[model samples]
Target: MPVPELVRPAPPPTRPGLALPRPAAFACTGVLLGLFLVGSTTPSPMYALYQQRWHFSAIVLTEVFAVYAVAILAALLLFGSLSDHVGRRPVLLAAVVVEIVAMAALGFAPNVGWLFAGRVLQGLATGVATSAISGALLDFQPPGSNRGPLVNGVASGVGMAVGSVLAGALVQYAPGPTLTSYLVLIAAFALSLLGVLAMPEPVPHRRPLRDALRPQRPTVPAGRGRTFALLATTMLASWTVGGMFMSLGPSVAKGLVADAPYVVGGLTVAALAGVGGITQLVLSSWSGRRAVRVAAPLMIAGLAGVAASVLVGSAAVFFAAAVVLGVGWGLMFMGGFRMLTGLATPEHRAGTSAMIYVVAYLSASVPSVALGTVSTVFGLTAATLAFAITAAAFSLVAALATLGHR
Candidate 1:
């Protein structure tokens, strides 16, 4: 009797001339991740411009940022595993197309409403593309290799750093602050869309749509509850710091640095992400648990430094703090992800991973708007210090959780 299709795995089929070589395909997946984040963060430096042009308050500014986070979360919840049913390449291509449209919306944005629309579209595109790209990387990994998680973290960090730095420079010196950056991104996405079309599908076997499209709830797999809880806390802590930098770091920098250049604001984010990417690369071979162990203290120290920088009103100190936080961010994510990957069954890995991200992005979203509103009432420095303290508390909790779990 023949075995059922679901019971036996099929051999991977060859696609001569249609598929990229394995190494090249793997590298392209990383590139796609970088580009998606590049689009996601390209709007950061421009927020100041938007505020100046539209006369919106800080509360409104954060709301704009929060909308993207909310949209991304919505997409993840709704279609987290959609690629599993439909295939990775199609979802990736569709996402890039949506990103292109979002870029165009930003380029031509005439009002605050248009900016919100563009942000929402960008969020949806990024949420879709991130899952597919990360999954593709794992599919293409060499046997016994642990490069997938590292690549995922590094690509995102590199993208955030590069996108913010480039956008800031362009906004300062280039003729079109808002329009030019999006134009460049649009061109990049157009090229990426072509690349996605050319790449072969990595996930060969597909499950039924009904099964794959089922609403995903973030849950810790059996026997993984303790580790998952700790890691979730680590993610929440690190992502809160990241969210603060991405959403409000620029404004905070502006308040501190006298006669600051536009690039100064972007520099805060760039420092965190660039240093983070480098740190992850340098420490890629370390065990995930070791990485987390190193990350906890660094997180506390970095938060302390940020608070000090705010009190002293020193850009150098702020930048230094950003660098330290970047290291923590890199290690924290890598460690938690590695641990999560080990604990989850193959069948449940994707959903488990998505749950972690959902938690992290939520951390990035809600507190930032609250900080903005508080800053409006109190002051940027006071608000930053308060936020840093809260983030530190979470980091300490994560540290305790990790220590107890091990």
Candidate 2:
């Protein structure tokens, strides 16, 4: 017999533990995400107050918030996939510089136009940062059995909540609300910059910035489209409600809560956001059968609860409903994101995520801003009802589309 060929044995599969992130790197990554997210919503709570100070109409508020969404969409369309080619660090660094400029502009803004310009640039920075930031933070977590997304998601949510709450409180009780708010943020932004620098660059893609600027819309197998659509719709429902809360919930609470501290207003938004962020932790990893099945029902119920709170006109009841709505929002968002990520190829992940964001941010901007303008004319009651109705309808569509997933 011929001597047996000596084939080299394949190397042992590297376990996740071997890939475990250094403790310092992991912690810093989480902090970076937190800082970025906190800055994202710092302006949300202050918008209503700005109205009080500057005497702008709700329409203007909508214009301001809408501008941010517009910028975000434009950036995502232009640069969402750039990290895939250039390396996450460079894109994130560029994002940091832009964010700093935004904060500075907001700090000293002399006119509504300046406010609008500041918000638009801020949105652009966030758009680029989030896609790479979330993934970068996840990289630090051990692959299996590590609550990677949840940790990152919760950090993102908490950061958002703190920014709003803190900014609102500082702006309300302290002198120079705008100036002080940005001063704190300037420090936070600087820290985010430092964190990004310390992180090792993810592998480079060897492509040009021009290549990344082009669209890479995802088209999964025909069989998987419904699966993909289900998640998309679910997010649509949840984020629609999110849009309502972010843009107008503070103003609504301001009317009913009577002499509400700016702190309360900020916390009100934070309360909903915090719950949604936490609920994501449970929903993302549940062993319960058919997590997706429950997502839509929860969203519908949450929408109903929000509608009820609006009709009842009780601030306490309103916040309670917000908590329930948050839970629903978390379930739907996490469920949808998981499905979206799973269904896409690595090449298309960033673009697809941006597409989902496009639907979400548009829903957030148009309705919320419309209500902002409407509240100026028809008053808060009509605007509140309008928002709830839109959210309800959106959820119904999502639920039905996702039913096929079962």
Candidate 3:
């Protein structure tokens, strides 16, 4: 398959005064991507608080989280390529605006309904913004540069880690546990909106809106099915670990450490996410295959630690497991993405990449709901033990598959 030239839109006519330099636009897009992920994870720490206040069940909490994932999957399928047609700036600007609204809704939420609405909007905003920003980064990257995916992975991981930690700290110490985090996010996103406006339009020609919106089902390139499947499996394993930690790690932490700091929940997520982010940056140079090979045991070990933590009801062990989980999550994500990137032709790249995320998000979302339901039926300990065993099983499967792959 022939590689298509990187499509760049003609720069919009120079308007009045200052225009952002190309480098600034690149940096701004990176910042925007980070901000989007941060907003997506900001609510994780608050879920426990919401459950406490509303007297809702664990099933309800997972449903709330699952709504965001559903919306994001819908948006990605519908508008994954929209920016390539209408331009990144417009799509990104609209996404930012939607996020602001979502944040406001969450900040002022009076009931569970409001939280659902806010999360749905947040998912939509993130889904739309993620594609555009990712595409924009590639567009702005120097021709033949391979740093775009690295940047994307790092930015997202950092954003999620930072958001979790920040919200956790604020929830513990701030006057309004629910309100304060959204307020801070609102301010950050507001600035990102301006940054989008100032970003350079990189697509040279606008394709028809109808054409761009046409649904292209996710497809793997010929002879790459095994490779795609392997990546997908690894991603599923990686995301399962993440989903468990993000959704229930805090509750588990609280159980183990009575009188735990309110920030403990956030700290739990931050530890996993923060280490994951740093791992991606540090191992950016490793071969994708090597990364995957290393990740399998790390994840399995981490999951074992998690199971141990639950059995003993130890906070210290839980946190220690989180660190191992973080390392595994980082490696699995970057390695799987890099493998996919290597397999895709230029024309097939976007679609292939989208499919990987579809799998990734599905892994992240559906399992959380299942685990939550299990937690409701069996105890949290029982549910967590089940989750760890299942996640470890997947990791072993992924490792075996990776080894079998040429």
Candidate 4:
């Protein structure tokens, strides 16, 4: 009798429709995050093309790059934790739409001013999406799993690599080199919008949107200042390397191999990013602190190798040094991110993630702009040597600090 009473099929389960399965959601979120980076770097291979078309100075080129980083910092400071209050899906959806507009601006632009405008838009979109997407990965992570940071690290490096390589090939071989890559990105983002629409909102109880919109200063949890400082140091060192490669690797490659095809520029970036991605996966089992300790020295050595490669004009040596740098970059990123995420509770995950990126993009932007200016005045080789020395010194300090901190 009881069984018969329960046989009414439970009213067809009125839950409004199934949410995207957690596994699917996790994968989709990762892919969307990667797409954002891909969009950012897709312009890297084309910077030379832009310079050729516009006759801009190296300083101007770096300014264009620096502007993007500044916009990202502005957005990150303002909207970093917004998703924690208003829910992830809405924030992500809006950002993606903005990203599509940015791609269009870059792809169809008639002048350098439009390029600057497009980069600012793209940077805003990326900054808004970064915290939300990274937070979503943490929210959707499988129970007892620690894959969130790994995914973030790997996605970043791999995405940049794919963007650079794909754009390079398109520029070298495709008809509409400047337009094709961004069009592809536009279409990819359009599909990502659908995925975001379907993604389940991970934030269960959202706060008031107006209050969340207030700009918040970046902060670490109380009593974690030393840990935060160490992590910041590591991030600064690692991401600065990334910044340099992304902004100037192609140009450096061209300098080394004068007759190489456009694809070499992309390969210059891919060597660092692609190898870094693989290194992260291979070293996923290592502890964060240990990875950083090991990575710092490797980075120092790699920087020395890079400087030597430039001095000798050896493309082979440059690529090899890039691989070394990639390994160091991958380990430091993975380790530092793991530590960074550990510093946050679920309540403040997005804000904390934003703070680390603030450090990262700052390192990426300021020094890169300086390097560009130096290149304009001193020459690329001299600028690169200075960059190498500075980066190596930072790496040493980071390692020493990490060791001294307990």
Which predicted model would earn the best lDDT? Answer: 4
What's the candidate order when arranged by decreasing TM-score?
3, 1, 4, 2
lDDT of 4: 0.81
By the lDDT metric, which is better: model 3 or model 4? 4
Model 1 C-alpha lDDT per residue in residues 232-271, reported as the tens digit of each score: 8877887788888888888888777766356777787888
Put down candidate 4 lDDT per residue, 1-406, tens digits, no spaces: 0000000001111123547987888899999988988887888888888988999878788888889988888887788778878888899999999999999999999999999999999999998897688778777768667676568767877888898899999988999989999999999999999999988776767699888889876668778877888767877888788888888878888788766456888888888888888898888899878888899988988999899999998988988999999888888877776677677766665557667767878888888899999999999999899989998988877777667443
Better candidate number, 1 or 2, judged by lDDT: 1
RMSD of each: 5.1, 8.1, 3.7, 7.9
Comparing 1 and 3 on TM-score, the stronger one: 3
What number of clashing residue pairs does each candidate have, in the order they appear?
0, 0, 6, 0
TM per prediction: 0.92, 0.86, 0.93, 0.90
TM-score attained by model 1: 0.92
User: Best candidate per TM-score, number?
Assistant: 3
* Candidate 3: tens digits of C-alpha lDDT, residues 151-245: 78778888887888788888888989899999998899887778888877877678889998887577687798877787678778888777777
Which 10-residue span in candidate 3 carries the lowest summed lDDT? 1-10
| Ten contiguous residues with the weakest lDDT in model 2 | 1-10
